[model samples]
Target: MNIFDIPAQAWAGQILIGLINGSFYAILSLGLAVIFGLLNIVNFAHGAFYMMGAMATWMLGNYLGLGYWASMLLAPLLVGLVGIVLERLFISRIYHLDHTYSMLLTYGMTLMIESLFRNAYGTSGLPYSAPVALQGGTNLGVLFMPNYRLWVVGAAVAVCLATWLLIEKTRLGAYLRAATENASMARALGINVPRMLTLTYGCGVGLAALAGVFAVPVYGANPAMGSDLLIVVFAVVAIGGMGSILGSIVTGLVLGLMEGLTKVVYPEASTTVVFVAMIIVLLVKPTGLFGESR
Candidate 1:
């Protein structure tokens, strides 16, 4: 390989990293978009919920000896049950209020949860190692790739697609959409609007939990992990415009790749690159690439 010529292996590795980041962005933003589309809540606590999911998995694996696969299945269910309780107890109280009210409520909830975790677990990051089954690296002639990274990308894509299909192609999805558009009409037509909303929230939170569970072994279950990533996800959603399911997915991966390219070209701007892109998008198209006026 020439000194100036691009190293194909390094390039492929960067793209793979970008794909993993994009997978996280896509799944997290999709969950946020889904809940917001129907409930009209900003879910400020989404990051906290994501962290809780990760923590739940770590704790389960620590105390109960649940493996990665079991944690993958159980973490979401537990976190989603918490979401249902939060929605029913606190979020439901402000359904008739302005969007700001729910936003503030969730924000407060986020702070409280963060504080609780700090008080209990402290601010230090905890390490969660990948399972033995996923511990090796694979050589694909061009580049050597970590198996866990491959698994993360695959799982995230599968979950995102499954959720999208559930919400777009099924009768339950039709009812959810109907309720989102007109709750009263949906109820009159025999749809259980409240139940639908509750389940929708649960599913949204469950998606976050899934993301968290997958992330723990890779990044470690930190108290502030979700808070940090949530900002990036928010930027992704802003640039993508949360208008359609597919748009969120595409924008996430595209932005992730863009970020990777930035790293290759301009290292200093990598951190703020997403926000900078968000600003450009807003200036050019306030409604975002896929968003519509409410």
Candidate 2:
């Protein structure tokens, strides 16, 4: 069939794929927003952490016989602990420096990590099969949707919501927000701002690692996979707003769907669609769809 003459089933499938992509974008960008908003540092190593998480899951399965479900929890925790150490040792040292320093430090770290993995694993992607329970597909009338993809969407939504409520409604979230708004004031009020910042950074990287774990079954663990998606995620964050939590979630999903739609109508532009949206959003809103104007 001609591209223009694609069937409804094809459209449904593409939309489902788009939603799945969007789910990942939302989760990744949510972590970015939390880190940038609270810590005032752009984490360039985020994508690296994601790669580590996927690698960790693969390692855990191959060596330790851990399943996908177990990897989901264990991988993040292990990666998060590493993040905590990095924060304490390196990231904490650069808190007083310019944002460029943090970005450069993280970027260098990303390159180092990617090189290490490339040397060990080679360029070929590793295999990671989905759990047997999620290995089937569900017929949705017009489309046959994969069970794993549906689970991904549901899990992403649940994670984003839980994160939002934690940041917007919970007591600890209040402290985080307070520190974000005015670290000195928060500290004066007895909040341990530095400790909170360290934890926040760790949490953000942990979230990225969690995304990687979720992605392993679909994309397989690869050294450069995270870098490939990082650019698009940066666009998503920009289009949604830098520090706006809701903006990141909404923008990520919307852009993912839009990218999918572009694939249907204009296949050549599919890859650039999110960046185009980013430019348009910058021109119109400047602060992003959900970002507050400073």
Candidate 3:
């Protein structure tokens, strides 16, 4: 084989890994986009929601005797309800304030939530088993792939597309945008602006939680898990465009592919490649790859 040539197995494996990571990036950043774009709140506690998803899934299994499939359905809903409560009690209060205020408040919440979980569960991570149906691997031509991972990628993609459609193409989405653009005008038009904001925030956090539930099947349940990837996911949002849903999905998948390719071409640069791409994008277009100027 030529020095420049790469083996199919190695390439395919890395691509799979990258796609898996990208699936997560797309989902997480999409949530951030929805929250910021519609609600104007910079939610720094998204990672905690992610962790909560995983923790909730784990708890459902270990405590409630719920299996993976059932937990997957229930955990995100549970986390989302918690998010709604948080929104009503805390986030709503800061809605009238600047984005910095929301960011700071959510950041404080992140710290507090993390600490509480740490105290209760300790730092050790909990394992979550994949459903029996997804326990094994499939034999692809190039490499063996896990059924669960493939499911994750497909599910993430479906969720992202559905959300994008809902936001960009639906009557309800139009109302969301209208409320976002002019709350007073929307309220005059008979839209429930405040309720809309509350629901949007809850949904955004729910998206983060859904992503977290996807993770437990792979990385297990850990309080700090979300914090670990929070920065990278933020970089993803910035690179894609701060509040652009489509941008988040596209940038996440592309950057994920780049990260994987970098791991193959040069292992050391894989970690830094995303930030480097972010810096480049920021320099070239501060509005992000897809952001519209205000």
* Tens-place lDDT digits, model 3, residues 62-118: 999998888878988898899999999999888779888998999999999999999
Clashes of 1: 0
List the candidate numbers ranked by TM-score, top first.
3, 2, 1
Clash totals for all candidate models = 0, 0, 0
Q: After the best TM-score superposition of candidate 2, give how far the Cα of residue 276 lies from its true spot, in angstroms.
A: 0.7
lDDT value, residue 214 of candidate 2: 91
Model 1 C-alpha lDDT per residue in residues 1-294, reported as the tens digit of each score: 343576777667678888989999999998888888778788888899899989998899889998988998999999999999999999978878998998899999999988988888998888898988999999978888889989999988898888889889999999999988999899999998889989999999998989999899889888888889998998888888854667677788888887776666666887888899999999999878888889
lDDT string for model 2 (148-214, tens) is 9899999998999899999999999999989768988998999998889888988998899999999
After aligning candidate 3 to the native by TM-score, how far in Å is the CA of 36 from where it should be? Answer: 0.6
How large is the C-alpha RMSD of every model relative to the true structure? 1.9, 1.6, 1.3
* Worst ten in a row by lDDT for model 2: 1-10
CA lDDT, every model vs. true structure? 0.87, 0.90, 0.92
Alpha-carbon lDDT of model 2: 0.90
Error of 3 at 224 (Å): 0.2
Runs of candidate 1 exceeding 4 Å displacement: 1-4
